[model samples]
Target chain A: MTDATATRPSIAGEQRIDGSDLLGDVEFLVARVRAIGSGHAREALAPFGLRVRAYAVLSLACGSVSPTQRDIADFLQLDPSQVVAVIDSLEASGFVRRAQHPRDRRVNIVEATEQGLATYAEAREAVSRARDRSLGSLSAEERETLTSLLLKVAF
Target chain B: MTDATATRPSIAGEQRIDGSDLLGDVEFLVARVRAIGSGHAREALAPFGLRVRAYAVLSLACGSVSPTQRDIADFLQLDPSQVVAVIDSLEASGFVRRAQHPRDRRVNIVEATEQGLATYAEAREAVSRARDRSLGSLSAEERETLTSLLLKVAF
Candidate 1:
């Protein structure tokens, strides 16, 4: 294993494995950043009894579009079944509710409960703090640039 | 749910729910990109009988550092138990071997076997192709810029 105190520039949470050449791989970098971000996010949401994936669902539920289970699954790149499970748990927690779709009765739109919005508001602040701390290395301008760049790659 | 053909600009895989405002979150963007990347990676490595996590381990083993299991777990942000299980599978497939660590008797250094290196060479090419398709949105220079920014955030 490479020494943490070694001369080489290291990765954030994981030590740099020079041989992996993953250092240069875009996919690898994306994964690494997500892993680090999730760790911070999980900690921030812990007191709220939320996982990052659930937080994502909660975030969407609070949105105005009133996404359906299929919408959440496709957007999050998660399986449809997983989305249902998360929605079930959120519904049980009184964070969200399923209502009949306006245009399509067959569809059940996922909406955030009043309590869900309140929890999300607090959790959002916590997430922002943790994200800022992890991304502290970036200047605001650089983060904006990074965000713009990531938007292109992610979308 | 918002219609897929809605007037609003949409995310690549997930529809944009304007209120989630997660559209502006850096961590969310990072997660989306990685999720997309992993899907492509899993498809590419399927032919080699390797999962993305296994490929990551193999990538490290083939590297010159001669990483220990702890090294892999730390770098990948996976549990130590998960790393051990992956190594066990890789070892069974004759892709890697756990040899005595030169400096620490208790530590086992993971090294790629000749067969493992051969499998990795082919798999790496497949992974590169998949990565290119997922990141096809960015120009070569843009990918480089993205990588640099991710390095700052990741490390």
Candidate 2:
């Protein structure tokens, strides 16, 4: 009704709700992009039997981060339970080994086994390709700009 | 291992897995931002008893687009099943009603009820607040640049 439109924000003729523009909304855009990229990354890594999240965990372990499960969870903004589940699967597959932190034995440090490191080497290639595809139409310069801006914002 | 380092990409001396840097990778950055923003959004909408995804779906309904569930899924890049589940819940909550598309009776078009529109107004404010909080350190101009760049790449 005219009264309703008069009371709240309106956009582009009609079909807008409460002034929020989903299409223009950066948050919504980021979410959709993540969903699309995450799906692509998962499919790319499927042959390795690794989901994107698992690959992320494996990547962290194969690095010098030497993160505890808790640290990984915090960095990735994942629930501890979710990080635990991935770690469980990785450990079961013998891709990684979890040991007590030498400095803090109460928390386990997850490290990639030799086999895990090898798989990540290949998986990294696939993930890199996925990254290229996800960046889509952006030029190399735009990609760098996007990455640099996002790093400053999200990190 | 020296052998491994010689064969593949390397980063920052130790424990680096291949050459990929998660920090610099735009895809991972995007995914993390999405996760962080999604979490904040969900918590903000929790008082309205709506998840971010559900609120997104509802926002679409309240608009003039008069979208079918399939259209919603396509726009949101969600699975058909996920879209269906949200429509079902929104319908049950008396927030939306599903009616056959006037031109294509086989598919249902979702529209918001008066109550749905009212709820969306409040929920939208919360989501807006979350958006502000998520973009924490970015300047107004930077937000514009980030949004503008993401629009070109994603849309």
Q: What are the lDDT scores of the predictions, listed in order?
A: 0.85, 0.80
The C-alpha TM-scores of every prediction are: 0.87, 0.83
Candidate 1 segments exceeding 4 Å error: A1-19, B1-16
Q: Per-residue alpha-carbon lDDT of model 1 for B1-155, expressed as tens digits?
A: 45645643333333455636788899999988888899999999999999999999999999877788877887888899999999999999999999886545777778899999999999999999999999999998888888998899887
Residue A104, model 2: lDDT of 51
Q: Provide the lDDT at A47 for model 2.
A: 97
Q: Compared with the true structure, what per-residue lDDT tens digits does model 2 show for residues B23-132?
A: 88777899888877888898999999898889989988877676767667767878899998998899888899988655445677788999999999999889999988
What lDDT does candidate 2 reach at residue B132?
A: 88
Residue pairs clashing in model 2 are A15-B63, A15-B64, A63-B15, A64-B15
**Number of backbone-clashing residue pairs for each candidate, in the order shown:** 2, 4
* Model 2 Cα shift for residue A145 (angstroms): 1.4
Report the first chain's TM-score for all candidates: 0.86, 0.84
lDDT of 2 by residue, A1-155 (tens): 75554432222343433323787688888987777788789889999999888888898888766667766787788899999899999999898988876545567778899999999999989988988887878889888888888887786
Candidate 2's error at A137, in angstroms? 0.7
